[model samples]
Target: MAYGQGLADRVRTLAPDRVTTATDLFGTETAETALALGVPPERISTIAAGPNPPGGVRGTGGEQARPADLERITDAILAGEITVPIAATFPIEQIREAVTLQAGRHVHGKIVVTL
Candidate 1:
């Protein structure tokens, strides 16, 4: 709750009721931290495993995670119920425009610039 001199960085989880926002995995070298935070590996059982690489959840924004939240999203994505739409693709020269569009919330999903 307080950001002082020596506090470890923390993130806000989508489900604060049952999620952790730290970058450490429950079973990795960060085990002690996870234990201190009360997030165990067993709580990560049903995650709708992805072909994507691990540590993919780390974000530019500090967002927290609960396994259930991940499963819910993965299920919807896999089921074609919810999709990440590529709203627009532009050329390299158009990168600035694309960013402006995104900043203004005019673009949805991912905005990409190609060669």
Candidate 2:
């Protein structure tokens, strides 16, 4: 799934043989764009039944309707099957530093704050 207008086209171009399905998680607005890029209507899908709100997939409702990619990651997190690297850890009092650290270029993973 892609949020941008031309992104699906670019992805299709990257792997024309591999990608058979596409989802416009943002809803019908991009469906035409996907179609224009040669994806069939039957291969396109929306996570929810209606128009999606402003924030795209994140704005869509709960886990039940979320795309498979999100579900996989969530399951992995819950199962402790993956680890999110911690770039730095700070106490709650250092929230500012935490934000600054997150904004920095060298921080590759999450900056965690502890209570």
Candidate 3:
């Protein structure tokens, strides 16, 4: 299947009533959509840098990072922490369960289904 930006689009459509006042660490492109809907730059966190940090978030590194890592290790671009993107927390073979977790069906983290 061809890749598309539909996922972002879906996020845009979430709670249309809040379209004019949604706020979070949505990306620049997503933030642009918010601006189009009357949101502000300061209200958003634009992490165009792939290895950069997300808003309100501390690091983007995987499981290898820790608080001590930042205090003890080299200041060499401290690994950024990233919340697990949906399916990573689950097995793909069990897609239905994943969808259930995403459909607001369960108390879970913000999730996404990726290929």
Candidate 4:
């Protein structure tokens, strides 16, 4: 879940030895930094979308998905195989507050705003 080089460097500096794997959903620069920090190529994985691709390495995290993949996921949701959590609900009038709450990032799941 690291988004910046600083965070990645911090992870490298403070990561526990027991942690054998890390996922970089940020970009390739962070992934390279992870490698420089002594994490093996296989242990440090990244997603294929976002600012950069995985630099030819297959992304271990499921951040990159095609339209078909999204469709399949939607189908699964419709089929009751997947569930979406709603952290909070608000009326359209409270949209501003809802946005503020989401920016706080303390909620456990999606925030729904009723129209």
Candidate 5:
């Protein structure tokens, strides 16, 4: 899921043959945009909070990550099969700055907030 229009637009531009799901967490506009982009109606989904949210689709409760999943991920990291890039890190005191950088959406990797 993308938090802003820029990322969503990037997804649209970079998408390959199949897009399994398009979820709009913020509102209905993303879904509408997907339709405008010729994505089949059934392939789009939206999730938001309000007195009455749009869209009728309901998610089948997704599975929580099991210990085995974490173990496998850890193994991958140890084997150098997975790499996590840190875009920026900030102490808890500079949380506002970190958040502002994150909100800018130009970061290439995870922004770490240290306690």
Candidate 6:
């Protein structure tokens, strides 16, 4: 999963079997990058926004997370089927540090800012 081109490039270098991008700016460039990385066209999925949308792309206003979905995910995490890495944690007073780390775009996991 990649949020932007920079991360996408990094992911591509790893030659993943599939690439999923949650970027509103997904376009030809992103697709090309994936292709160059040897990811099959059908294996690349992207999320885009707008009324017209891109050709051959279906638009879903986006899915809302139901309580059951959240519960299932939580259960998976608790069962060790899913793992969420925490890159760093900061107290609320150090929110700036957390934000800075997040903005650096090099984080491989979630950054938690605690209350």
Residue 9, model 6: lDDT of 65
lDDT winner: 4
Please give, for residues 1-115, the per-residue lDDT of candidate 3 as tens digits: 1113563456556655555333334334454555555555455544342454333322223366687875653443345433233334555667787777666634434554446
Residue 1, model 6: Cα distance from true site in angstroms: 11
Clashes of 6: 0
Candidate 2 TM-score, C-alpha based: 0.36
The C-alpha RMSD of each candidate to the native structure, in angstroms, is 11.3, 7.9, 11.7, 7.2, 6.1, 5.6
TM-score of every model? 0.30, 0.36, 0.31, 0.43, 0.44, 0.51
Off by over 4 Å in 1: 1-82
Query: Model 5: runs farther than 4 Å from truth?
Result: 1-63
When 2 and 5 are scored with TM-score, the better candidate is: 5
1-115, model 1: which lDDT tens digit per residue?
2233322335224234645433332223333333345665443222222332133332222145666887888898899976567878989999898888888854446788899
Candidate 2: residue 61 lDDT (0-100): 43
| Per-residue accuracy of model 2 over 1-115 as CA lDDT, tens digit each | 3345576667677778755545444345555555566666676666543754222322234554557877897898889976577779999999999988777745656788999
Model 4, clash count?
0
lDDT of each: 0.50, 0.62, 0.46, 0.66, 0.65, 0.61
RMSD of 5: 6.1
Q: Which stretches of candidate 2 lie over 4 Å from their true place?
A: 1-75
Better of 4 and 5 by TM-score: 5
Q: How far is candidate 6 from the true structure (C-alpha RMSD, Å)?
A: 5.6
Stronger candidate by TM-score (1 vs 5)? 5
Put down candidate 5 lDDT per residue, 78-97, tens digits, no spaces: 89977777899999999999
Off by over 4 Å in 3: 1-13, 20-27, 49-85, 90-115
Looking at candidate 2, the ten consecutive residues that score lowest on lDDT are 52-61
Cα displacement (Å) at residue 20, model 6: 12
